[model samples]
Target chain A: MDRIQQIYNDEKLLKKLQEDQNLTIEDVLENEMVINMGPQHPATHGVLRLVLRLDGETVVGIVPELGYLHRGYEKMAENMSHIEFIPHTDRLDYTGTMCNNVGYVLAVEKLAGIEAPKRAQYIRMIVSELSRIAAHMVAIGTFAMDVGAVTMVMWTFREREKVNSIFDRIAGARFTTSYTRIGGVASDIDDQAFAEIKQFLAELEPALVEMDKLLLSNRIFIQRLEGIGILPKEDAIALGVTGPNLRASGVEYDVRRAKPYLFYNEIDFKIPTFSQGDCLARYFQRGDEVRESIKILYQCLDKIPQGEVIANNPKKVLSHKTEIYSKMEELIHDFMIINFGINPPIGDTYLSVENPKGELGFYIVSNGSGQPWKLKIHSPSFCNLQAVSQLCKGAMVSDVVAIIGSLDPVMGEADK
Target chain B: MNTKELIVEKIKEKFGESVEEVSDFRDDLCITIKKDQIVNLGKYLKEDPDLQFIMCKDVTAIDWATRKKRFTTVYHIYSFKLNYALRLKSNIDDNPPTIETVSFVWQSANWYERETWDMYGIKFINHPDLRRMYMPEGFEYHPLRKDFPVLGIPGSLPLPFKAE
Candidate 1:
């Protein structure tokens, strides 16, 4: 011991003394057995690999191995323009592209001190809620499937498609709708786009009711879930759990209410919470949240102020093929904005919106150049992944899947 | 108290020269402290009833290449009630930048500090569970450093595949 102490230092020796004297790093070993929960594991929800140290049924420890799908997205952002970066954000949370787009654009706006037009904010609110519904659909759908309810996934997506169709009408694409611009939306919402969204909402309520009937009261589903994967309120705060997980733990902290941004302040919606922080509580909390999201979407549509989607800045105009063909000046503006995206002032902003998962914030640092010095995506799934290790302890290996599924982690964002 | 000067005044009144909460540590409302004083500052921030900055939102580093102080460790603290943020930065060396872990203040930082350590090589001396967060198995060289390459020779500075 004296010889060992002599080599390191007094501080090292004291630390060694204070630690569980009999224990070593080697003693905290991954020995018993290996259970590789896959890059293709259905419970994982994406290309997520969790290597668990198992003693037969119980997981002794878990080693979360990511980057099977590292797009090198952070490094890629260094080269892309601010506008060009929107589509990439869509891919981050493949479940909810609109929130990703709004969060990112709002961040760029904060640095530039540009405000989205009232109409634009209203439109953004509509699309973001639609995306939230879509995200919750995927979360609840896959979660139900993970715990063995086959039909709900199909029911949720069937309605989700109607929402996607509305998005397709507005932004010319369903999934990666790079809809929100720095100052406003890419363009104004037409009568047709508004009609389609209204139609979708009308149809959406019944689908949600059907989903509740299908999952909420199902005996086996409730049995499998209920008290499983419980995260208490105080522990949830200590672990920095946010979004639905925080709400599930009964904290009632929503970023939209906590720190208002864009049209969130104007819009009225309830923040749903559950006293029980179980997997079932999280599942039901999201179900109720989808109802609240529908309410918000209805409010936005009812009160969407009459105005242009993009602000009056001529420079802000996007080059649509139709516009380019019709007007000579439009051609030049389109190419310039397309080739070189909006250049915000050299500053930084951490603009977060209540994304589908939770607090989806973008921390963008601009160095007086068009390119961002650093683009730190404070993704909700990435933050929530920290809770898995704690949640999985002393539980059966099968329970790990339920716990992970309840969290509803998207590996794309987690790995990003 | 204005959000800008609340932390500065509190730290100045308490620790005096032990810390400097300046508006422009890197041209923001930055609170600069000596490496040794981090634990005390963290504890004070936690127990002090007025500033319930109980949450350590993130722990990261900024590389000022070849400056007198090479790297700065920035700790972001968030209080839901105050609805404001404070950036506490500390200057640490390039060689395995080590600071005492704030696991005592916030348990969330356990994984966060490890992630920072894995990405930027900033060692949290008292981190109870200091293991890799993102990189692959047996990886060496912090990937997030200004100079560290995205690609490193596999198995170069490899620690064993630890499951903690």
Candidate 2:
């Protein structure tokens, strides 16, 4: 009590505190504090823990601790057959299961030297693009909610549910839709599902316009996000940041344009890029990407040719269920495939897809066997999360959530 | 010459003997070079005006359990300038395999190298802060190693302490 009274009575010390209202971080280093942000915190979006060292309210250093949800997917892939791994890919990025399905199947097809039929390729493109739109919706919605705009989540999720219903109609499962196969898709889309997709696309644009009016131009939202967490272009590329985050930092590279897997080369769309490299820029980039994905989806729907959905490679690709039950040849083939997996040739190939999060890749090494010798998943979230420490340093503690939301990391893929 | 031939020729010209194997599979270039030349090659690939392999996409290892060289460390580096990705592999013959770290070259490699070390039990020389990525600090076994079982060894992973 005496010490407190003395300090309170000390005019010089009190004067110094009052005058130096804008104290630099170095001035408060003597009272350095350490805080653990999460392994269970909601702002992290999943099981990600960040150990932050703080000098007053300024974050001096941050170390991200991960792998709370690691199920050893790589080890599991080695044990299972290539065909058996499709369902597992759905769990990698739960928000964009179709994209993960497409990525894994394409990798397997590339490794086995199997070409997907033209119709199947078009189907793959449509579903993956729709999945991309769904993922960006989640990203933008949660991002706005994180920054204190609550209504945007409702608007974004409404559109997402429409996309989910479309998925349910075509893929049978709304969430974990293992819709793609090694040489083709699981099933074909019917006329009703196609009509539903067309209607959803028409509704999405007006809803986006409403969302833009509500959140994008609002003064408080812009002020909260505009210049927060700026990741420069050079640093973004050097740190392996990809997808919307890299594009927001002014990198024009996209896996669809760069590699041209499937019929993406034939499709016309723009890769949205912004030079600001801030939280607002990242948010705007997602909005632009959703628009581009919509464009691609419309083109796919228009140009889709009517043909066989699954490729005719019975040796590598699985036969339809009806054929397996009715035809003797398909039954024998199904039996053989179920017991012994499709054996890819002895070689290694790495195939990446432009997943909404980033470059989701499968590096498969086949030793002329049903099971892969080694499988490495090059997940983009794992790479993007690495740059968090660099971004958060010297920034206010409150902006950490904003930075994480802008990155839009799915912990399933990161922890996988 | 095409991009593939040009890249091979440039790499071979710079380091002749170090370039051990160069092959094309699925239109991708896979180069196996001596472990000693990895850092040098990485620097050259990134710094050269023509080949700006600025992005390090992945760093992983293939565990060949019974081979003479127990592990093969692989790197997939990309050059936006060339619009190509090149795969580089180097063999580590030691038990508890030890190899040079390229995290210094690519900032993104820091976490990837940590992950590689955690999964394969491969020691990366000169790594900044080497620690297990997924498992706890006291966990003994490397889960991704070939000898490690799918279901995991019984009594290996420690369970949480329960109150009486």
Candidate 3:
């Protein structure tokens, strides 16, 4: 007790505290308090640390400190071959691994000037939409859980598990399904896989409707969320926030619709936009997107053609394992490819797909080499997370959690 | 004329000599302009009515370890009005590469510029908050630079202080 009193009464310690905070101890205790919310917090979803400056319960300022999950993926991409990096991409936005895989392979394909066959394109579209639905489930569930609705998480995860099982049947892995290959998928979607997907899709609608009634229709949920943490349309665009968050702000600019990659031009689906730019609108925007994704998936199933899954680009696409084992020429080709890697022409190209979270793009600069000279990933979560400070300026401390939840930033992608 | 051709012509007309090289690779338009002209070009691209490149999609740097101008800063800007995206590249020849910040032009450039700086160590002049984006503040080496080894330098990333 004497030692504690001595330290508290020390002039040097008091002076240092005053200097560091630019305020006396009394002032800090009376008015402003700085609190570190994360690096590990349940509401933050991952290792995102938010240092919140609070005056009573109201947040004066919030600075989001990232990089706790920094894996240096771009540096790793430079070190490995194009095919060798596909699995690495699965770890980017773990919720939407399929979307990341497709985004990456599309970039590599665009650089090499090789197109996946029509069937493969439709398959890619199907898998990407499925991945979108699964990702949004986690987003909507975890977001509801963040805003004090825990039951929605169980319902959403149940649906997500069904999607995972479908993936397991198709890709042989549930979570980190590195199913996408360079010029095509690992294998064709067999009859059993199609049957499972169709069954899951049928089961999904009723489950989603029930979940909606339990959460979205509840009076408490509506009152808690409606106008909390509003980001205007102008700010949304200026900050480069994409995906459903940007759509909720009334931007209507979807990469699939605007850019039209892999025959998305032929597909008829609405880009759901909500004028309100609030937390509730962002949540509803994702719900609407799931409907659109279902529509796209149905269209894909109907319009999928019967042909070769992989493109016949001898230099670019990998050969079948059976052919590699049996044929001497195929063995030599596989050997050369494994050793030297597929050499893209001397050029660079940036191709982005409309991922579930936002636009996941890969900018590849190839110096006519087996591996990329430089690979830059433009992750949408990293951009969307930037708007949190602006949104949470004068809101209550709890609203900060809601705003971060609304952004749905996966730290793996954000810090990559 | 198409949007790409229109953009290229306008860019050429506005700042002809500053536009170092213009190339269309894989249907994407890339314009390599002088480093000093980045700010002016960014402003023109954003504010111009027809070429309202409102969103700065990404900012990254490419390190050519042996090149005279060792680093090239790249910006991918998108326009909703035009329904097209353009790539802007500029070479930095300084001892420690320095370039102007385009955050004032497009607000999205703020984080992207910070990330580029964190990864490549190219300084963005007049950036609002030019702190490290992904790496720890105490960490010295830029991981993305070609010269920086893949297996990082030992003892560079300091661990948390232990309570004695």
Candidate 4:
């Protein structure tokens, strides 16, 4: 039977009834007391609330409340065409938006049934890895600050500035570089960008190595994380956890390895896993992943392929320039492409990509129309969030911050 | 067992007249069963060893605004054993929409079902906790429905104030 116990219209009335109806009887039976952690807390990388039922600091139950940052993304996508949705993807994971942009566009490309050119795929891999590194830096650095290490945040920001400058050189935006277009990319890699990437890679290496030295083996950092918030591998998978959190639990099922998307099949790297599903395992997993990302960047630099960046589908789409200028014939075609979006011949498609968090999937159904008939994003943050309730069942109240930091959920994608 | 063949073969083998599998499932599979048999199908999918479609990935209402009786609750599920996926669609009425819950099968459906109710107003007959997830409690209206104007609340039929 579908248990429809709570109703929105009657929540207060129900709670009020529960308060007075069985208060003498229920309270005599040792009922659990609810405590609200936050809709705004320092440890939750974004705005997240956890309703905990505690028996004197030992968590009896957990209810994760979300949607503080719901920007109406799915509804917003319905109003705009496919191409117009590029900017919206940037808001999913504001920390590492490049990966989010590629994740959405990849789904669009799958529905349209076309592949991005070799050069564009390689460039996407480069930019996405750079974004991955930047995201990990913020996650770990800020997580360190949450536990009382203020020094790591400054170091990470300094390193992140160097990385951001490279993105600024390419797309002229540091924070939200919507560089990924559907077919290929928004633009090409110019001589200036090529030099900046080479230079940044050199400067970024020692910073990561330095971070490893500073944080990983430190007694205080390890004490806060090592045995805190442990989740069993079986429990994590059963809870629908994905991305690094699952890998840190020793799953070893990276989507990059399981289902290689975006030139990932050609690239070589190790998928790191640790048997300990504690906060420290998650912390070091990101560290190992950052090292792996650096390895990917180095490989792409030496053997970058050469070809036209965007797809060669003349009827479907073209570069941004051809759409803006040129003859009226070109203009009409461009207008249809932008206005109508790619009219994917009536079919359903599900495409997922490995983000900094986990498997961020976009399940889309098209009706041979301009807009999507159905769109359901399987946000990894939303799925991984289930483990939190299970993981914190017996932990102290203060450890909730460490548990949240370990999961690293992005509310943009969660509430979207 | 191959998910496509098991779903088709098992349904016909067990309940001959009630099931049929659609072609082109290399990407994902879909099966059509009468709405009345939804509970049976839900139980079978949950219990069967080879086809343990245990996790209910998501549940959302698709509004074909221009079409008649325009409503459907799409169920996405994943089976770790089959290493496969399936989309089960159950039809709902345009007004007073409702569907059977698979919450008993997937405990994770508690909040997901509530969110679907809070968004599209598709009532899950026996959901354990059916309340607004993203939106505030005691608010009357499903925000995700197409007819619920981009900025209007359903009950009051007035502009949805941004701050409130």
lDDT of 1 by residue, A1-416 (tens): 97776746778766767774686766656348777889887788888888898876888788776666766566567667887787898889998998898998888777766676788888888889899999999999888888889898898888888878888888889988888877788767799988888888888888788889888678989988878878998788778777999899998889888878776788778888999999999998899999998899888888888976776564654645576789888878877777776666665556678888888777666766767766777678877877888888777887887888899888888777
Question: Model 3: how far is A212 from its true place, Å?
Answer: 1.3
Distance (Å) between predicted and true CA of B127, model 2?
0.8
Alpha-carbon local distance difference test for all models: 0.79, 0.93, 0.91, 0.79
The prediction achieving the highest lDDT against the true structure is 2
Identify the superior model by TM-score, candidate 2 or candidate 4: 2
Which pairs, if any, clash in model 2? none
Better by TM-score, candidate 3 or 1:
3
lDDT over C-alpha atoms for residue B120 of model 3: 89
TM-score of each: 0.86, 0.95, 0.96, 0.87
User: DockQ of every model listed?
Assistant: 0.28, 0.87, 0.90, 0.35
lDDT of 1 by residue, B1-164 (tens): 67656767788999898885465422245678888898898889877887877766667666555676767776777776567667677888647567888877888777668767876788888688788777775676667666765464455755669898
Question: How many times do residue backbones clash in model 1?
Answer: 0
Q: Model 2, B1-164: lDDT tens per residue? A: 98999999999999999998998998879999998889999999999999999999999999988899989999999999899999999988877689889999998988999999889999999999999998888888888899998899888778898999
Candidate 4 lDDT tens digits, A191-296: 7887887787787788888888888667888888888999887777557788899899998777787678887888889999999999999989998998899899
Who is ahead in lDDT, 3 or 4?
3
- lDDT, candidate 2, A1-416, per-residue tens: 99878867999888887788688866666788999998998899899999999988899999999999999999999999998999999999999999999999999999999998899999999999999999999999999998899899998999999999999999999999999988999899999999999999999999889999999678988998989999999999899998999999999989999999999999999999999999999999999999999999999999999999998877888999988899999888888777788998889999999999999989999988899999999998898899899999999898999999999999999999
Chain A TM-scores in order:
0.87, 0.93, 0.94, 0.90
Q: What is the interface RMSD of each candidate, in Å?
A: 3.5, 0.7, 0.6, 2.3
DockQ, prediction 3: 0.90
